[model samples]
Target chain A: MIRSLHIAAKDLKAEFRTKQMLNSMVIFSLLVIVIFSVSFGDLLGDSETVSQLAPGVLWIAFTFAGMLGLSRSFASELENGCLEGLKLCPVDRSAIYTGKAISNVVIMFLVELITIPLFAVMFNYNIQGLLGLVVVIVLGTIGFISVGTLLSALTVNTGTRELLLPILLLPIIIPVIIPAVLATGKILVNGDISDISGELRLLLVYDIIFFVIAQLVFEYAIGD
Target chain B: MSTNSQKINILSILTAIVMFIAAYMIFFYLPQMRDTSGQLLDSSFKIFYFHLPIAITSYLAFFVVFVASILYLKKGTHNWDVLARSAAEVGSIFALLVLVTGSIWAKATWGWYWVWEPRLTTSLALFLVYLAYLMMRQAIEEPEKRARLSAVFGIVGFASVPLSFLSIRMWRSAHPLMFGPSAQGSSGGLEGTSLQFTLIVNFIAFFLLFATILAYKVKNENLQEEINAKKQALP
Candidate 1:
């Protein structure tokens, strides 16, 4: 755990210095939000329905952005040949997996936080649901990043990883996406934890399940 | 060569006969669901016979992949790798068939091409999972690494099936009864004697068909391996 934290801290310091993954995800998310606002502008007469659709739209943007961040999480390591250096260390492989996953989640969380307000302003929506949206985003991001981290490791060594990462990652993440999207929509509407308890519980379940599975399989994935 | 030719001929003949019988049962033998006025709406409902069997066989195909993958990881044998690949290919083919037939049936029953319903969505997810598996297998060039990576993926992919099914079912509330009769998706869908018999026969026929296809696929892979070995020996 300590070693994992060191790895996470290392990645965090590097990410803060460069912010390559961070920049693209933020810009990509804003693009998605703008596109969605344009697409839905003509359909709905009132802002109420559009506001309600915010959660779904927000998630779609976050997911697309998250995909790029996940793929790039290991790309740096691959390019710099750092994975071999890490593998040569007397450390459990899963520590590296967990470390990368945590960094991905943090980076994704920052992206989501920035996107929410812009998303609200662009769509003419209220920020009363901002806190709830944050919670949903946190839970959803952790679940997705956990799976994405392992998959990035799996495909990072493969050819055309840009294509392989999303192809393999998306289908497995469907179970996570369904519950998270449903829960987010509910939370945005009611702005309370009690009402969306089912979605919340399902999201937690999905997060834990995928997180543990990633840990167990991380060895087989990158084991030489 | 003569024995091999004769074996192929027998398997091909058996598969053809069983396929025809299945087709016949679907069209002529199965009892159609009775309408509100007790009239038979028999023709298009026949797709259910083929539809459900193919779905079951697709699941069976994945089951083979799961077992073979486990064996490959355990024994590190080339045979298990080949079997896993064959099963995955056949499985993806059936999964695609299930989607096409399902879409056709959905069009007939729901008056729409697709819905966010549980079973339909779940089957779509399953199809995508196996498609990804195939793509993963192709992405890697090294045979050993490819086999190991895909074996690991095959295991996790199969495990996701139930989670995908449950999450979608719970999230969507209800769209349809999943796998029941066309209009009345409530009860066991197999209402009458003929309907039951036809479903059973078709299932048996599909099992036979699955076996035949898998056998041929594995045989082809083995033959390809022999040819490669012979070329290597020539040098």
Candidate 2:
């Protein structure tokens, strides 16, 4: 586990030095919000309808931006035989998976942090249940990244890595996406943590299930 | 080779006989359904026989895929990989049939070809997951690498089937719950003994058909592998 943390730190150090992926993810998510705002210009005036739509919009931005970041997660390792170097390390293959998942989740959270507030500002919506929303976001992002990291490694060696990743990832992640969207909507509209307990539990279960599955299968995914 | 062909011939014959019996029972043997008010239901109700069995059969195929994938990963053998690939291909076909038949049934009963109901959405998700599985196989050239990566995908993709099955119970679904306890109540079960019997017959028929197709597909794949091996040895 500590080795996993060390690997994550190494990835963060590299990522922070360049900030290329982080910049693109944040900017891309902001653009998604901008486009949504433009498209729903007429509906923006009504707080009721805007609130109804905000949860879906927020998750779309997150999913799309997260896809961008995940596709790059293993692609970066391809440079300078960094993947080979990582594999040669004494730690287990699952350690690499955990490390990559951690970095992906951290990057996704950073992107969401920037995107969510801007989304509120542009949509002219007031935030409620901020704590609940954070809980939902954290669980949802963890679920997404757990599966996304494993699939990223799987697709990286394919000829159509970028195209194949989303095709393969999206359908599999439907369980995660549904509950997260529902919970986000509940928190944003009703501000009742109690109302979204079911969704939160579902998200939590999905995170654990997929994370464990990914750990067990990560060896085959990255094996030579 | 002769025995193998004979076995396949016997399975195909059995499948054809059972399928004919099922079709006859579905259309002619069973009485037409009526609502509680004694109004005659539309003939589209018959599609349920095909739709439910096909859906279950598809689930069976994916379960095979899941098992074969794990075996392939554990043993690192080519046969398990071949079996997984064959099952996934057949499963995707059945999954697509489930969607198509379901849509037709929906249009006749619900006045819409589709809805955002949990069952329908999850079925679509299931189909797309396997479709992605097949596409991923095509994207890779190396046989071993393709097998390993797709084995992982097959295992992960099968997780959707249980979720699809449980979606109706998990959420308030518009889809009818024909058997077992549902979230709404213990309603929506077939009323007549004949209806239940015909459903059972159709289930057997479809399962046989799935097994037949899967057998043929696996044989074809093995033959293809052999040809490739021979060509490689030519030099």
Candidate 3:
């Protein structure tokens, strides 16, 4: 656990010094939002369509941007032999997996922090139930990062790392994305929290299931 | 060239003979199914003879992949990796046939080409997951790493299948089962089997055919591996 924490902190410190991933991801996040707004600009007059579209757009932006940050984290490691150094450490490989996943979840949270409010401000949509929305985002990000991090490792050694990430990820993680989108949309539409409790449970279940499976098998993905 | 290959050839020939018999039974002996009032279902329903059987065979093929993947991870065996690869490719083909035939049946019956029905969506997602496994395999160059990584991916992809189905059913909020609640444990169940005897015979035939194809592919992969190893040795 200490070694895992060390790995996580190492990445976090590096991220702080360079800020390369965060800067690029923030820019990427902004562009995704701008693109979404421009595409939906014509429907700005229709509040109903905007409300319905807002949640989906927010998630699509968050999900794809998270994909970029996750891949870049590993891309750096793969290029600089940091991954090799980490693997040479005398620790359980699952620790490295957990550490990477933790840093990824934190990075995604930071990205979400920037983008979620930006999405609302840019689109002129009101987000209700801030607490509920935050909960939904946290759970949803966990589910996405858990699977995405594992898959990033799996694909890091491959030839087409950039393209293969989304192809392998989107389908397997649909269970997570679908419920998260629905729940977030519900909150955005002024629906009661009671309305999306089922969606919340689905997200929780998905996170736990994938988290366990990914942890148990993480060694297989990156191990020698 | 060897006794094992000779035996596989014989088995494939017998599989062909059995498939022909199944076809004969489907087309010649079995009559078209009729609904009430003496009205016959569309002749397109005859695709059921191949479609349903092949669908089940595809599921069976994926199950083989799941097993072969687990075995590969546990034993680190090249044979199991070959089996898993062959099963995935063959399974994807069968899954594609399912989608095509199911689409045609829908067009004949419902007058539309497609619907986002839960079963259809799950099947489509399942096919994509299968293809993703193959793509992942192609992206890796080293043999051992590719085997290990692909085995993990194979397990993860199959695990996601049931979750994907559940998620779709949950999101759609439908009856959850094709056969409704009342249909459970009843003789007159929902439309699981349209033409029961014909379906059974075809299933048997298709399963044997799946086995033959799997053996043929695995045998050829082994041959290919040997050829590659020998070629590398020549240098």
Candidate 4:
């Protein structure tokens, strides 16, 4: 586990130094939110409309932007031959998956941090129940990035990285998206936690299930 | 060569006959759906027996593919890979049936051919995922690598089934399950011995059809292998 964390920290430092993945994602997310605001300008002027759309905007922005990071993350490892080097190290392949999943989640979580507030401001929504909203975002991001990391490894060796990720990832992550969106929508509308707990629990269950599956399957994806 | 060709021809003829009978039963024997007002609805209710069976079969095919994928990775056998690939191919066709019959059902019941309802949305997502897996295979030139990557995807792709199933439950505030509480277990539309009889026949038909397709695909793969081996030996 500690070894995995070391690998994860190494990835984090490498990601920060290159900044290619992070920069592209951040810019892409911001652009999506900006475009959303412009297209739905009249809709955004209404508090009700903005509140309802906030969760969707945040998810779409985060989900699509995160795809940019996922497709390149492991494919680049294959491109640069870093994957073999990492495999040669004395760590379990599942640990490598764990590390990568952690880094991806961190990057996605940070991106969500920026995108969510921007969405709130652009749409003139307060994001009342901010604490509960953040919990939903964190859980949802966990579910998204867990599945994303596993899929990135699978698609890394495919011919077209760009086309494969969304087609492959979107279908698999629907469970994550539904509950995340529902929970966030509820929080946005100021619904009681009692009303939204079912959705939240579903998201948590999805996150745990995918997290475990990704760990077990990571070895096959990375191995020849 | 003549004998092998003759066998395949016979298989094709048998499949054709079975399918013809299935279609005849679907169009003739199925009862029309009556709304709450006791008015007999249009002939479109005929699409239900066809649509629901195809949908159920497609879901079953995906699950089979998922299990086969896991076995392929564990055993590293080409046979399991063949099974997985064949299941995926037939599953895609069934998915097509699901989409078409679903559209027809929607037109009959909801007055719109496509509503993006929970079940429809999930099935659409399943169709797209299956297509993506096939496309991924086509995109790869290396056979072994293609099989490995696709198997991994096949395993992961199924994870979305439940997600799509639950999405409707989460998002729709007003619309409840048509039949019951369980997301996919609702028997609202089908009642009495009719439901049981239809379900059993559909399962048998789908299974036989599935086996026929699987055999054909495996034979094709074997032929391709033989041709490849012959060409390599000549050189």
Candidate 5:
């Protein structure tokens, strides 16, 4: 566990150093928000509705941006052949998965932090229920990263890694999105946690299930 | 060589006959449409005999791919890889049948051909994922790498099936069966001997049809391998 955390911390530091992945994700997210605001100016004129849609918008941004970041995780590792060095280490392969998943989650959380507030200011929306919303994002991020990390490892060696990850990841992430979107949307509308508790529970279940399965299967997925 | 070819031809003919009989039973013996009140509005509900069975068979085929993928990873045998590919191809075709029969059923019963229902949406995503698997295989130049990579993807892809189903259910879709069929164990849908028998026969028939197609696909792959080996030996 300590080794895994060490690897995770190292990954986080490396990711922040150059910032290619983070920069692109942030820029693309801002562009999406800008396009939405410009095109749906009248549609989102109602501040209340915009606030309600904020959670959905935040998730959408993070989900797409996270896809790029996940693919890049492997792409960057392979470009420098760092995976070989890591594999040569005296660490369990699942630890590698844990490290990568944690790093992906952290990057995705950072992206979410930026976009959620940006969404609020853009639409002049009062975003409350912050705690529930953050929990939803974190759970959803775990769910996405769990599966995404495995697929990234699988696809990175393929001929078209970039094209392959989304095809593989999107379907698996559906279970996560359903509950996350529902819970987040409910919170966005200031709905009580009890009202969306079912979705939250489901999200938690999905995260746990996928994380375990991905860990078990990640070795086979990346095997020779 | 010609005599062996003749034997294989006969087997193909037999499979074709069985498929035709299944189709006949589905279209003629099955009821086509029925109302929600458990009343046989008309015999048009017979299409479901084919529709429901094909859907079930497609899911079964995907499961086979999943199993074969596990075996490939376990043994690293060429045969399991071939089995996975054949299953994927046949699964994709059955998936096509699911879409077609589903649209027909929708048009007859729901007054529209398609709605983004939970089941249908998942089926669509399954089709696309496997179709991409096929495309990825074709894009790669190395057969070994292609087989290995696609097998990995196939196993991962099948995991998505349940996810899509559950997700669609949790988040309501525009599909007519929004709440899904009653789980209260009521005779809400099926009624009468004709409807029940047709549904059962349809399921059996499609199940057999899938088996036959899977056999043919595997055989074709085997023959292609034999030809490649022969050519390589000659050179």
Candidate 6:
């Protein structure tokens, strides 16, 4: 675990130095929100409908942005043979997977932090139960990144790296997306924890299941 | 080669015989279904026999892929990888048939070709996941690398099936539940022994059909591998 943390720290250090992926992810998510706001401008007048549509739109931005970040997570490693260096390190192979997943989750959270408020302002809506909403987003992001990171490593070596990631990742993540969207919608509307217990449970289960599976299979994915 | 051909011929002949029996039972041996008010239902309801069996067979195919994938990863054997690929291809085809037959049944019963129901959505997700699996295989050139990466994907992709299966039970689903306890009641289940027997016959038929096709696919993959070996040897 500590080794994984070290790897995570190294990735963060590199990511912070360049800020290229972070910047693009944040801007791309914001643009998704902007475009959504523009297309649904008329519906914004009706806060009722906008609240109904908000969760799906919000998740779309997060996932699309998350995809961008994930596809690049390993693509960066291709430079200077960094992935090979990481593989040669004195640690378990799963450590690399855990570290990459953690970094991907952090980057996704950062992007979500910027995107959420902009989304609220653009749609002129108030968010209730901020903490619950945060929990939902966090679990959802973890679930997405767990699978996304592994698939990113897998696809980075493929001929159509960018195009293949979403195709490969999206269908697998449907279970995550469904529960997260439902929980987000409930939290947005009522802010009631009791109401969304089911969605929360589903998201928690999905996060754990995929994370462990990804850890077990990460070796095969990145193995030479 | 003779033994392989003989085995395939026997399997195909058995599949043909069982399928004919199943078709006969479905069309002649069974009575038409009726509504709660004693009104005769549309003949389209017959598709349920085919639809249910195909869906179950496809699920069975994916299960094979899942097990074969884990074995391939564990043993690092070429045969397990071939089995996984063949099962996935067959599973993809069966999954597509589930969607197509399902849509036809839905249009006849619900007066719509499709709805975003949990069962339908999850089935589509299942199909797309395998489709992506196949596409990923095509994207890679190296046989060993392709096998390893796709084995990992095969395991990951199988995770969706259980979740999708549970979604119908977890949520308010419009899709009919034929067995076990269902939220919408057990009205959709088979009623008489004849109905149940026909369903059983169809199940057996489809399972045999799946086995036959899978065997053929596995043989084809092995042959392709041999050709590739020969080409490499020539160079």
Which docking category, incorrect, acceptable, medium or high, applies to candidate 3?
A: medium
lDDT of 2 at B101: 99
**Residue B44, model 1, lDDT:** 67
Local accuracy by lDDT, each model: 0.82, 0.92, 0.83, 0.79, 0.76, 0.92
Worst 10-residue lDDT window, candidate 1 chain B: B180-189
Worst 10 residues of 3 chain B by lDDT: B181-190
| Native contact fraction, candidates in order | 0.58, 0.79, 0.60, 0.60, 0.28, 0.79
Write candidate 1's Cα lDDT for A67-167 as tens digits.
98988888789767798998887899889988888888888889987898898787776656566666777888888898889888888788888999999
**Candidate 4 structure quality by residue, lDDT tens digits, B156-229:** 88877766566666555322344556544533454667645655676666666766776788778778878988
Distance from true position, residue A173, model 2, in Å? 1.2
Any idea how many clashes model 5 has? 9
Per-residue lDDT of A72-158 in model 3, one digit per residue for the tens? Answer: 877889766888999999999999988998898898899889887788888886777888899899999999998889899988888
Q: Model 5: runs farther than 4 Å from truth?
A: A47-56, B1-18, B30-44, B164-187, B230-235
Deviation in angstroms for B198 in model 3? 2.5
Off by over 4 Å in 4: A76-80, B1-18, B31-37, B164-189
Quote the lDDT for A151 in model 6. Answer: 97
Q: List the residue pairs that clash in candidate 3.
A: none
Over the full model, what C-alpha lDDT does candidate 1 score relative to the true structure?
A: 0.82
Cα deviation at B69, candidate 3, in Å, is 1.9
Clashes of 2: 0
Q: Any residue pairs clashing in model 5, and if so which?
A: B30-B46, B31-B45, B31-B46, B32-B43, B32-B44, B32-B45, B32-B46, B33-B44, B33-B45
Fnat, model 2, is 0.79
Q: Cα miss at A60, model 5 (Å)? A: 2.8
Cα displacement (angstroms), candidate 2, residue A8, comes to 0.7
Residue A85, model 6: Cα distance from true site in angstroms: 1.3
- Chain A TM-scores, all candidates? 0.95, 0.98, 0.96, 0.95, 0.94, 0.98
Stronger candidate by DockQ (3 vs 5): 3
